[model samples]
Target: MNTISVQEADFDVGAEIEALSAGRCDVGAVASFVGLVRADTLAGGGDEVSAMTLEHYPGMTEKSLEAIVAEADGRWRLLGTRVIHRFGRLVPGERIVFVGVASSHRGDAFAACEFIMDYLKTRAPFWKKEDTPAGGRWVDAREADDSAAARWAK
Candidate 1:
């Protein structure tokens, strides 16, 4: 089964991975990534960020994420995938996102997990606003993120 969620609450990394790989004998490898909020380097030209609030159009966001997962599944020999992204006000050092992939081999799991992350960075319909000492400012898309996602294009 493939699980996709866009929630406001933080998630447990281990439990999510276990949910993805549980009772699956064919799954020989599980690859995962967890993204966290950092105060040191935030968007909007801030050296210190107090908190970041993520916003998304609920239904549209989930559909976009599902499409990303589907594309990766089609390209790789994956057993299952789970993607969970958090929205709302989040402080530094808080868990932001999780991407996990289960496959029969190390290569497929790693590639698919990375591919999913790369796509999610660019394709997901989530906007961020950072609360810095200077005040609140909306975060813009970074060119570096675009460059990373572009490599996967056909």
Candidate 2:
């Protein structure tokens, strides 16, 4: 399942992974990645980021994530995959993204997880606005993110 939620609630990473791998005997490995709201950006000039509001094009966002996951499935021996990304206003220490990959071996699981994350960072249509003491600012898309995604090119 590829899910994009815009809620003020918290997500449990352990629960998500368990659900993704449930009852799958063929899955010998599971790799997961969680992204959190950091207090600072790379610019290093903002106040403590007290909260962040994530926005994305609804239908388009899920489609983009599904495509990324599909690419991973095609490239690896994946048994299953789940990606959950949250939008809306979120406080510090809140979970931003969850990526889980299940495969028959450790190598496939690890590679698929990294591939999904790298693709999402650039291809996904999510944007973040951070609340700081200086005020709110929209985080710009990073060039490095594009470069990361490019490594998976055909």
What's each prediction's TM-score?
0.94, 0.90
Tens-digit lDDT track for model 2 on 63-142?
Answer: 88888887888899988788888888888888998888888899999999999999999888889999988788899888
Tell me how many clashing residue pairs each candidate has.
0, 0
Each model's lDDT comes to: 0.92, 0.83
lDDT by residue for model 1 (21-128), tens:
787698899999999997865455646989999999889899999999999999999999999999999999999999999999999999999999999999999999
Worst 10 residues of 1 by lDDT: 38-47
Show the lowest summed lDDT stretch of 10 residues, model 2. Answer: 1-10
* Shift of residue 116 alpha carbon in model 2, Å: 0.7
Among the numbered candidates, top lDDT falls to: 1
TM-score of the candidate numbered 1?
0.94
